[model samples]
Target: MDGRKPTLKSSQKVSLLSSSVRTVIRLRRTTQVLKKGLPSRDSPSKVLQRQQSLGKVKAGNQASFQGSQYFTFDTSAQPPQSIKKKKKRPKNPRVLYPGCSRKYLPTEHKSKAKRCLLLLVGIICFQILNAIENLDDNVMKYELDGLEKTMRREVFGQALAVENVMGLLKDYLATHIHNKPLVISFHGPSGVGKSHIGWLLAKHFRSIIGHEMVLHYFTQHHCPEGVPAMSCQLELSKMVTEMVTQAEVEEKIPLFILDEVESMSPDLLDTLGGFFHTNQTNEFLNAIYVLISNFGAKEVTDVLLQNVTMDLLEAQRTTEHLRTILSPVLSQIHPLWTSAEIVPFVLLEKSHVRSCFYEEMMSEGIYPDPNHIERLVSQLGYYTKGELELAITGCKPVVGKVNLL
Candidate 1:
């Protein structure tokens, strides 16, 4: 009667739930009977047939499946389609001897391969030649040592000069290919071993390079006394050019020594300047030019005497000092002064003169008698006085005087 729905009794509710459960059971049983009577959608025979059809279809068309986006079965277990592998050809046989030429190689060898092989061989040959050159240099250095020893033994009282000249020669040999020719001008008084040193150098070169490579010209001996300067210049110019040209043709470094260079005409000295220029070939770069002169002898003698008297170190008589004192005098006499390096041979002291006398006596196989040596030393005293003029009784006459004694 009220506007609200009435609640059912417990017994009535239970009976209604049982009726619903019975309805569900009856529907399930009807479904089971229908399933047993009808055919299955995925039966084993149908599934097998479907799989065989899929296998026949191409891999490219497998994407046409309706449910491919949501479900996929693995097909990797299937064997792969037939495929072929490429085969490599074998290399052809060819000659292997070192003496065999490229033309004798197998025709199958590529030009690029042949070029690479030749390049490797050429590199090996070049390395061998380089090693040989180093061996030759070692031999030359040994020879140079012998030369230096001979110089010190032969030239008396000029050990400093000998050492300096050796240094210059060593430097020249080290950079002969690129450096300028070494122009050395030996300046000192007469009979002081200047010319003797030059001769020794020439002799050493002759023993090493050959006699034709060493050229010696005593300016006084070559240019006759009282000859006109112009005629002397022309003759000297021709002689020097011919000598250098011949050395070049023979592939030898020329060794030129102009003894008594102080006597040469100024014009002749000027003509020789061109050979010492920096911009020259290796032929001239390796050349050795020696000018033995008596110019600045007095100045050098004075310096040595002063140093000895003052008890100063012998090292004060340096090359730079000699160059400074001698440069002005040399420039006045010749135009090639700046192109040459001046090396002074100091005036021999009394002890040096005594040593020279003893050396000469021993050379003659004479007994080392103190009395005989004393007499010779006394006779040579006058020459060691640093006199401006050449001594008549200097070392030049000591050998002759020792014989008389």
Candidate 2:
């Protein structure tokens, strides 16, 4: 036996090589089929099981050279969802006024800015209104002070009389006692500062001066000559009612002044009783009524002359005493006098008349020499007239006599 290895022929070697190549290709085809059966990233596990079953069936007739067609995924089956954006809402515009201290904001926040501006404007308007009301109150106080000062400084020989009236007014304003109207009657001779005092009051109260709320009736001019007393009373009542209605509408207190009240018919004067009664609720109940008369002129003159003769001060004749003395005199004229307060307009003495004369001369820009003043004083005739005439007249003529000088 020979000791040598056996060797295959060339044709057999070629056949063997072809079979090995086919085996390798078959193994690769199996692997690719398994890979194709796996589920895609987006597909469910149930789809993987269905694909595996279909691959097994297809494997029996599978072609080995199918390229990459089995590996390609169908992405169009589920497209990526489009992202949606939310829309924003629009805003309102801001309004601005003069003198505002706010900064401007962007248009996007205009609604917020408008609300803030409105709040600010409301606050500012409130402050302005408060300041205006305070200013009005201060102005009213100033006017009242000026009125009091003018009365005390301008009117002479009636300090106590003026002060009493002022006290009544102050009490009325402070306490708001509205039970009835303040009825004051001036009882004294003419030119004794009764009319002048009334004029001062009218001038000071500008709201009522020359206004319909203030009714001044001079008996000499207002009384109709031929009219019957009843007719006159009816007409007066109608006029007063109309004035009172107007005053109530305007929220003002009515002031009625009857000058030369002694000359008025008793029936005409009595017509005011309806308004003066405490139980009455008419708008005129809140009115102030002033009656100027010479009913107690003789009594006032007698008291003053007695005081002068005794060299006594006029202050000794107090308001209470004068009131007691004049009450009976006033009651003689009208029954309404019982309800009214009697304020005596003092008779000006010779000194006060002389002072008035000097003041008149000064106002006229005529500086009087001492001798001229003496002559002016001499011209005044106090005792020449009878007691009745003297008691009825007052220092008013002194100004005319000064003019004559």
Candidate 3:
């Protein structure tokens, strides 16, 4: 047995070396065998038997990970192979597609598709370039027909002395202001049309540029409950500068809308030296800034006394008083809600209010109580001419009396 061991080893070594060389010519042999003795796809055992008869081990091929073993498959005892069913793709439902919609996902799968290859990676994204080619045959084609239609101005309330104010606003907006900003302010009593004036100016040129509002009450810095609320002038100024920056980055034409300028906490208003002009790419404002407030008006006399000055009547005289009183407080407001006085809009008048209320209501097919409308318009007594016009542009048809204390 010891003497026969060398002979067995020699035979095995020869077989392994010959198999290694034969692997190179196996491709040529496979072609001839396939043409002459290939069995049906089901009879793989027969093919293996024929190869083995030709002195090939037909065992493990290293390339496809076949090691040294061939299945001496017994044909008589061969087991069955379980065939798995492949999942079939769903068929396209035949629909009368006559028009193409951009946002529609079609059910049909077409063999031919449009391809867009982005970066020359040889990979192409496929999509049907055009679908529902005939517009006359479909009604869905009109889905986006009215998208570009112009919107008519909802000039509801009165048209007081607002014409010049509107013109001034348009001109001021058209011309850019660098470091020196004009202080246009709208002052009035509570429930007056200060906010409405701001809204009007915001939408003056159909507001092609969207407006950004820094509302005092809504932002929680100044609450409606008569609490002095926190003065966030510095915070607000920072907010404005930041808005300008973000808008520039996004390439968005956004406006800055600040409401209730007078009620801005005394802490912030005291600091009026805040400056927003900057030379940096992201440091400057690329926005139309509009700051609004009722304190600019004579009616918010209480605010002036408590925060601005002891002699309340003096501060109520003009924007100069408001600006002068806040000079010492300017530093507190930066880098937010800067030093510029609040910009005013065109004022509204009594007749203009009535006309707007009537026209806007009629157009909407809405008829609010004439008495309520009159009562609301009467509040205009405390408003600037521009503000009153904004107030009456139109009263909403909701049932409620707006109590403007």
Selected candidate, larger TM-score, 1 vs 2: 1
lDDT of 2 by residue, 1-405 (tens): 597778899999999999999878866765775689643343467557867988987875454333456665564589878989887756785566568576665766457888999999999999999877765554454255567788887787777778777766654443223787788888887788888778877656545334776777787787857768887778778988997778667655667788878777767777866667888665767677887887888788777655443223546455567789989877886778988978887666556666777778888878877777767766665633323122234568767876765
> Could you give me the TM-score of model 2 versus the true structure?
0.59
Report the Cα lDDT for candidate 2: 0.71
Clashes of each: 0, 0, 36
Misplaced by over 4 Å in model 2 are 1-142, 175-177, 207-210, 308-317, 382-393, 403-405
Clashes of 3: 36
Q: Which ranges in model 1 have alpha carbons more than 4 Å from their true place?
A: 1-142, 228-231, 279-282, 309-319, 382-394, 403-405
Stretches off by above 4 angstroms in model 3 are: 1-161, 172-177, 181-183, 190-192, 202-207, 210-238, 250-253, 270-286, 299-353, 356-365, 368-399, 402-405
Assess each prediction's global lDDT (C-alpha) against the native: 0.73, 0.71, 0.44
When superposed on Cα atoms, how far off is each prediction in RMSD? Answer: 17.8, 17.1, 31.2
TM-scores of the models, in the given order?
A: 0.60, 0.59, 0.36
- Candidate 3 residue lDDT tens string, 1-405: 666544467889999999988875776667765788754443578666866875543333332343325544444775878889998976995756557744467688744333333433343222222222232222122221121121113342212214324433444334233344333444444333455555654553233433342222223443344554353555656666666666556544345555655555555544322434444343353344555654434423433323332243442343344455444343254334453543222233356566555555565666656875676566543323332223322233211333221
Better of 1 and 3 by lDDT: 1
Residues 63-166, candidate 1: write the lDDT tens digits: 66644787776666887778877677668956466765544545674679889999999999999998778656844743778889988887876777888888
